[model samples]
Target: MSHPHPELTTPPPLPENGLRVVALGGLGEIGRNMTVLETKGRLLIVDCGVLFPEDHHPGVDLILPDFSYVQDRLDDVEAIVLTHGHEDHIGAVPYLLRLKGDIPLIGSTLTLALVEAKLKEHRIRPFTLAVREGQRERVGAFDLEFVAVNHSIPDALAVFVRTEAGTLLHTGDFKMDQLPLDGRITDLRAFARLGEEGVDLFLTDSTNADMPGFTTPELEIAPAIDKVFRHAQRRIIVACFSSHVHRVQQVLDAAAKAGRKVAFVGRSMIRNMGIAADLGYLHVPDGILVDIKRLGDLRDDELVLISTGSQGEPMAALSRMANGDHRINVGPGDTVLLASSLIPGNENAVYRVINGLMRLGAAVVHKGNAKVHVSGHASAGELLYCYNIVRPRNVMPVHGEWRHMFANAQLAIQTGVPERNVVLAEDGVVVDLVDGHASITGVVDCGYIYVDGTNIGGTDEALLKDRRILRDEGFITCIVVLDAATGKIASGPEITARGFVESEEIFQQVIPKVERAIEEAVANGVRDDQQLQQVIRRAVGSWVGGKIRRRPMIIPVVLQA
Candidate 1:
């Protein structure tokens, strides 16, 4: 198997009839999925998306794929083919369009609608082409075909790319659910046909490759959801991904059967479901839907609330309700159902929400306790079936972390794909497909571009480190007045601290240390104000690290008096 090597440098110019595959994101992580496919001097992008910020990423809104590799070549891009409507697959569309607005976006009808809705918020009227399953379109140097794939979201697609160098199949976050709620199973017959036509390289979703068996069908959750709705004594709140149309459909059906009026709570939940219903992907029973404002008119037993934050996003509706910060207070006799799988890295936050809701006397049901959720990605057995059916000459696992991808590669190898043909790569690693074989060529400067509120790509690691320090170790500021003539302290050395439990009296212990450091620095002919500040900073940092055993951010202000 080919792997990224530290010794690898800039890859040689693309060999004749070679397709260079560069992943700007989504190789090492579960989100921020994007890939740049270049051949014949033109690029075809698939699935531009975003990664949600975790607790460690303080104050960050979103994490985007670094477009530096293709920033200069936006004009050379042909079009972007979306695989699905999931945020991890389409959330970054607006950000990418901000760079080059005219890049044509191609996807299924529902997928395009979700993206266009998001793009509308960015005030970008994007150029979009809606295509469904079995449709083919030639975009620049690549011939693309869309295949229907069943996922948590409706109208998800697997893209088949044809070029002079090779044919690459990208299965964007899918599972083979024989009984999907929308009745759209992953088109394995198409996979077999593509295999017969000779697929040179297959890029499959590896999100659940480590799991052992087929994923439970979406239909299997209906009984459980019905049970929840039937047994709830009062107001029922169901939380799921905003884009999960199938789950929402299930919720609506259960609510209607239970004779409860449902209200969409979050802005995204209302928007996406509206789009899905308008586009015929979602089926909302008549008289079952009600406005959130009118929720108060209904009795507790007659009301159902469908909200976002199954993953426990702080600002999301369910989280706010859990924290008692929202208009919908979750309390005694209320039933809160988390109907989505817990996303990796969100366990703590989700558990906290669960505990908070439980503390408020709400009965909480989640994946661990009930069949409320099922994974949308294929497991090892399903991947094996895909590998054998696609029968590609080479395999490159995409859309998963290292373990998931490695397990996927093993599944491919077990299905008769040669071991050496499997390419294991991470974000920024470049792989080139030539003459039916894929190999890692080199790496690119694909780093995380942070989105903090309205600021895109403005937050960096240093700022995040400072935020962590402030959150964890706290910060201390020292104000000192320096005499111009003597280069010594002329007045106060006032110290203040935040985010730590240390007292003002404890800070007094470091006052003399700061004064002595300034005096010694002045005696050594260090008169520069900035230099004096560094001296004071060093003194405070050393004292805090030794006495308090915490390395908080220390700010030293040297003012001339």
Candidate 2:
């Protein structure tokens, strides 16, 4: 059913007796997965995560769900249930914990370990309860059952939450990889079992809902990776997301088979793999792995290097290596295997890193040349199979942008789910289920809260607009020493620029024009600080656009002397 617009819809007084589902993020976005499930004054948050900043969110370290709703009702929240360890699923744990310290975090073992490590980074030691597949845990007014789900990381789980209102199944970021590297496939049998139990609502990941085919099994990539290890006569480096334990497993297996020692580079790659190996999720045969400092001890053909930054992040290990700034460098005989999916929007950066590596005489093998990377989210076929198996009366597609959500809704409709039962949700839409009936009731004030270093929130549109302007056209600041009583210029209306195209000579030529504009604003009796600033801003803006064909941010300062 249609939901009220968030701007118009105030939180419909939490129903007297119904389960209200609201996504603070991850419905209309690709990452930062957070969903709030509420009933009888008790609230449960599923997968508090973060989204990486793109070209648009310049200078933002991470994008998190505005947790004001939960923060406002901290007493109502029972626990935080995490499905996996991926950043998008657990990145905002510290932020959430900071708001309210006592909320218990419940997830699978690997998931808890990663989250614990993150919390430790923030010096936060919150209550963490680790649950396993098939085990049930009761938190507040809900019971949660973790179902084994195969994904990029180990110990990923799909949570089947039971409330007094109904049983809602949330399939966290998952793929039904039949031959997963870890031999732990998604528990479709469990889904079928849950379906038989009568699930009221099924919220599935829609990241790849538009893709037509099933995701290729994770096992398929190891053969190609092994072949690379077998054929490479020089040092071989594989770049991928550090959290891909399965890929790291394959790399370890390949290194062992090829009689080469593996060195983990990059802080994230080392820390995450160490945690995985310690947790028994990653199996590194004795003598097959070596310290990073010892990478130079082995000859080219005797070493296998695994690093992060498959997305071409600037400071990531692979990017640094490409620019010769990394401790480990590759040359003529080396091979750099980019064993990761090129996330959309990362094509440009990834290709730039590839070009740089090629310029360094290193041959790069990636998804383009080989099936080294497969998607971690369910494709259309997998979604259909899940829909048919789960057989929930209501379908709410989560974890995708708007297009993906609509496509997933269409798929749900095609799979015999009533069009009326399929809810197309954005970030703040609340899907309410009562006595096995579902409808989008109202909305919440939820949006993105940017994380910049130690700073949180207040990263508004105006600041972002200023950043964009500064990045694209640079900035021009005019300093005016003014008469205190009269508000008239005392000395100079000087201009300074950082990134604009105006040279010293051009600026000198335009100085008179700028002064005339200011003089005219003054002669016209523009005395109010705001009015004066706007007058100068518009005048300079017009001159810049007309003369230089540029649109720079104009900062006009008026001082009283």
Candidate 3:
């Protein structure tokens, strides 16, 4: 089944009089997320992110937001403010710098450190500015304050943008973690202060709006890992997100308490751990972290392995370990704990890893049987709590899918926000704030841009259409002979097929049928490269469809020479 692409509607020109918020991405998906705030011709972008893999796109590395709308308005973009160091929040920095060189990027120290590392990897440098809690800065006509918020990652912040139109709060992905691993909680007092100050519009994360209750704190998972580690007779391996430095720290501390030495395995996990430790964000005791190469020197019971690929990323250390391709392998009596949930579209890959691990006689624990992993975004109750605390006249749900946004909007209405004030925004929909009231003024051209290797290109309906065709139909190639003088078909048409045919006998039988069709077309005086190619293609398509009950992409190459 094919999903219809949303039509591109041009947003009503920015109101010359009020503040406007536009979400380019992260409104109805998990990645390639970005949001723009325009007040009096100045723009402040919040959380440039990249989307993870999807089902149809098997080998895609990352998907980024199409910045055509903002590309032309780069001068108007005062700053790109980040909320955290998660890939979805900071992954697009390299791409952004590739397009627009050295714009002022602002975030917390940890977040900025990660961004700097990412930029350095790309051989591009940017003007990075660190933002701390309560640090207010002015960019153009907008006065912004970064309020620290707790989540899976440390130093997460929610942006409070004060404009002439009104006060707007853009909550980057956050949760009400009263007992976060970092010991810093989401500031309820600050939220209440903003509410008291009369917030006009609230842009909040809707990633978990459909789920009920507040997300469990990161500290809660430590005990579970400790318990598993203490009782495990053999080695223990934990798979998690590399960017979750706080979670990694928890795992390390738990390993220490269990009297096990930990080893970082995956490339991303190793790189991030080095960064966090160097910056004093993560504290791994000396002699606790040994090189993976030196794992043989330690006892199995004393080894605690922390690696990446919880979502079953093929090349991730955990996945490779499960398949016995990794240098460090888990055998019988080993415990493999998946400390992260299987993100949507990654279930199959994750299950493959699980099956591989089970094949090696290892015990596996996940969200189903263990309290190892918890969401980083607020659930329905927490969403309502944030809504009540912000007390905004307008509530715009960002950073989730259509269902999540709809559920979040419902929560807003349930919390006394008017139904009309609850706006369901898509990629380019712009909501204008006028005199404390908000309305969808116009649409903008906002969509996804796929990054293939180093080439940046559009990921439009046409591209998806081709992908679907290739997936469903396979591919067909036809070679036909034509008279160069008259542009007429003269000889036979040969057909070739792959990824579709089952046996050599069946394919051979189909070839004669195709040749006969070409003969018939030539007898009918079919000529002209364009016309001959079309005739051969249509004939081959019909023949293949009738024989196999499938429509393959028919490529007819007519030779005039």
| Candidate number achieving the greatest lDDT relative to the actual structure | 1
Q: In each prediction, how many residue pairs overlap at the backbone (N, C-alpha, C within less than 3 A)? A: 0, 0, 7
Write model 1 residue lDDT over 117-157, tens digit each, in one string. Answer: 99999899999999999999999899999899888898899
Off by over 4 Å in 1: none
On a 0 to 100 scale, what is the lDDT of residue 455 in model 3? 63
Of 2 and 3, which scores higher on lDDT?
Answer: 2
Identify the candidate with maximal TM-score: 1
Q: lDDT by residue for model 3 over 338-432, one digit each (tens)?
A: 98876767889999999999899999988889898988889888888888887888888888888888888889989899887777877887788
State every prediction's TM-score relative to the real structure: 0.99, 0.95, 0.94
Which stretches in model 3 have alpha-carbon errors above 4 Å?
Answer: 1-9, 458-472, 483-492, 523-525
TM-score of 1: 0.99
Write down the lDDT that model 3 would get: 0.82
Candidate 2: deviation at residue 365, Å? Answer: 1.1
Which clashing pairs does model 2 show? none
In order, candidate lDDTs are: 0.92, 0.86, 0.82
